[model samples]
Target: MSEQTGKQMSKEEKDARFEAELLPVLDPLYNFAYRLTLDEDDANDLVQETYLKAYRFFDYFEQGTNAKAWLFRILKNSFINEFRKKSKQPAKVDYSEVEGYYNTEDVEGESGVATTTDMRTESVQDLIGDEVASALNALPVDFRTVIILCDLEGFTYEEMAKILDIPIGTVRSRLHRARNSLKEKLEKYAKSMGYNGE
Candidate 1:
């Protein structure tokens, strides 16, 4: 095998390589961990444990591959294996719930006559970014993870799939649902703040 593609690295090499690549990813990984754990202390511990595991298994990583995805995969797995058990959180409410709620509401037809009160006069887009961030924090863990990774962190669907160990279709669907959920939550928050378009 070529030197670059050869068998696993020595202990020193592994430590060096992991330090070089994995350290820089700590902030992004911490952001993801915080989104999952929703606590600063837990996020720090989770990231530290993830780095330790990644360092121990550094040889398994292939050279010249997407290190970010590889590191993210390690972080995600560590979160699932360790933190998920203690959390006991339920998955986010599905799309059917949202659809059912909407369907139950009576609205105007194409004629545009009077109908049920449209209390949704305010758009969430008007909320400041920090308020949006807080609203994001209020989301369920599942939706928050997807939004942080895909929307805030700018990871592509394929990378997210690899990181989360799910199919790309699942990533896309979760992202769609997560964004809708965030929008709804942000709108509600903005309305609560008395943001009636001004």
Candidate 2:
């Protein structure tokens, strides 16, 4: 049956369909929202708003299409249109001074001696997850959103492009830049914590 026919379903049927199809996407949506807002309260608000919009427009959803992508698109649009508008902050900081840090050569002496410790030697990922999260939080909202959607949330580049209403090329480039930016931030944090470049 076509999606339009499905939309004419009874309330119970609609609810059943929604639960079966859409509910599974909630956790990912929540994670995406949390990363975007970086505040529990704001994340809750965004998720709630996303659901409301989704529920209201559920009939328009074409069955067999990617429900998660559809929901993400709604949530992203809501964020940009509503939440993003209210926050008139700059998207990027003046990190020019820190730019050189990223350009620094790998941990090798001029004589080609390996000076840096191997990152795999220390299982500090768990210890640093929170710090990495904080660094992600400190990033510009746009970059943070892309990172969470692509990395943490595990959305494909195409899915993210659909969600963000951007071209696939833009999605790839943004994800690359965001990851690089995140790595730079985490490296700074690691240094501060005396991680010895490991």
* Residue ranges of candidate 1 with Cα displaced over 4 Å: 1-6, 87-127, 192-198
Clash count in backbone of candidate 2? 0
Quote the lDDT for 14 in model 2. Answer: 74
Q: lDDT for model 1, on a 0 to 1 scale?
A: 0.71
| Model 2, runs deviating above 4 Å | 1-7, 86-126, 193-198
For model 1, which pairs clash?
none
**70-176: candidate 2 lDDT, tens digit per residue:** 98888888888998776556763334334344335532233122212434565667646766776777677788888887777788988888888899999989888
Q: Give candidate 2's whole-model lDDT.
A: 0.75
